[model samples]
Target: MAPFLKEFFPDVYKKQSEIKDSSNQYCKFNSATLTMFTSSLYLAALLASCVASYITKAWGRKISMLTGGITFCVGALLNGAALSVWMLIVGVDL
Candidate 1:
């Protein structure tokens, strides 16, 4: 969590120093950026699941799987290369 916050969210990373005197790490890092960082992945997964059946039916199984795999790979790569918070939200994959 600290390293993640440090990379894309330096502003929030500054707040981590407050944890040095206590064990309430969870409470210390519940910033809005953290919420979006974690929740975006779940939201993306939900939307993908909702559309997956339709995509699978519209295309053949092989095409559907290939498309899904390509999309997942691209999303993962984008997430891995992200340098900003908004980029993370846009490309977050599970």
Candidate 2:
């Protein structure tokens, strides 16, 4: 998924640059920023999985699955509505 997102970075950056003010840092992210974004997601997912395992053990598979589904839906909505690069990152992190 991270690799897929990276593949679209150029298009995403172009559109974001067009929509945002020229001075906005969000519109100026370079390849290093992309690497950081992907790395952050990888780290967050790793930590979340560790915590989710405990929640699943305590709550059972059904509850865990439902919680995950709801969380994913909320994240998708956030990502879809994001107006800035930071918001998009937050949404993806969610």
Candidate 3:
């Protein structure tokens, strides 16, 4: 969390690192952004899962799995190459 914050939101990282509170370390900056960032991935997974069986049935299990793997790889690549926080968030939500 610290490293990610320092990489993207440097100012937030600097201010957060100055805090004496250890228990609330990861969330001292912005709860809303943190919530959205963390929750979006789970929400995306939930949405995908809701349609996974239908997709598998339509495309067959092998093709469905392959497509999912490719999509995961692409999202990972996007995240690895992300230039901004929004890009990172989008990659995560993919």
Candidate 4:
């Protein structure tokens, strides 16, 4: 079971190096900085997910879903408008 899980999620183990390469391709940064930036962005998204989940509970499932849909749209627009890493970060924050 353990081996099967590990094989199935090999990307999970290799994701950091892959991401570091991708980040370097997209932006001028060292691996360490890239890791921090990616981690920060992930943290932001996780927080957003938590907030959305809570709001969904308070506002009803439909309303929460609608809000999440809008957030997804905004995120796509941000990606399209991204000129730099900072823009990407700001877009995700939005």
Candidate 5:
């Protein structure tokens, strides 16, 4: 996904390249920024799962499912309307 984003989004790819080149820690590796950014989704999902489990236990399954569905739709809208990589990241994180 990181590689695909870099290939398809020129603005994001360029910004990531600049950031990577400027950061000493990531300067040694190409696509390091994108790799980290993409990998964060897994972490976000893991954390969201824990929260969702609690929500389900407290609110009931139906409510929990509806909330999740609504959240997903909102996140999709945010991602679709993103104007920059940061916005896209925020949307995906949501």
Candidate 6:
């Protein structure tokens, strides 16, 4: 399996362990439902990301990057300080 996968997609195979670690951590944080909900939100965010990319195209890369960084920091703080699982979900959306 290793030989077959590496022959086809070495970079993807190399990242398998990290993917597993992320999956394990995701499961530990919440139940399966929450994980699925979060994944759906992530997909939604990816679609939103395309809009963001277009909106920021004329705004300058540095400014857009900083805005995204700040938004992520705010989200992390809310998630870390959440009082309930629902709040955590809302925070993750931020």
Which predicted model would earn the best lDDT?
3
Ranking by lDDT: 3, 1, 5, 2, 4, 6
Q: Candidate 1 lDDT, tens digit per residue, 1-94?
A: 7788789877777876645766554666658887878888899889888788888888868887888899888888888888888888887753
Better of 3 and 6 by lDDT: 3
Model 4 error, position 29 (Å): 8.1
Q: In every candidate, how many clashes are there? A: 0, 0, 0, 0, 0, 0
Higher TM-score: candidate 3 or 6?
3
Q: Estimate each model's TM-score.
A: 0.76, 0.64, 0.78, 0.59, 0.67, 0.54
Give the residue spans of candidate 1 off by over 4 A. Answer: 20-26
Cα lDDT tens digits for candidate 3, 1-94: 8888878878777877688777865556764666677788898798779777889999899988998898888889999999887787888766
Instruction: For candidate 5, list the clashing residue pairs, or say none.
Output: none
By summed lDDT, the worst window of 10 consecutive residues in model 4 runs over 1-10
In terms of TM-score, which candidate is strongest? Answer: 3
The CA lDDT at 4 in model 4 is: 30
| lDDT tens per residue, model 6, 10-88 | 5545656346456354333333544554585787488669867875888977887888788788878986786555556
Off by over 4 Å in 6: 1-32
Candidate 2 vs 5: which has more TM-score: 5
Off by over 4 Å in 4: 1-29
Per-residue lDDT of 59 in model 4: 93
Better of 3 and 5 by TM-score: 3
The whole-model lDDT of each prediction reads 0.79, 0.70, 0.80, 0.65, 0.73, 0.63
Shift of residue 47 alpha carbon in model 5, Å:
1.5
Any runs in candidate 2 off by more than 4 Å, and if so which? Answer: 1-30
lDDT of 2 by residue, 4-90 (tens): 344446655555545646666553555665776677688769877987899899999899889888887887898788665566677
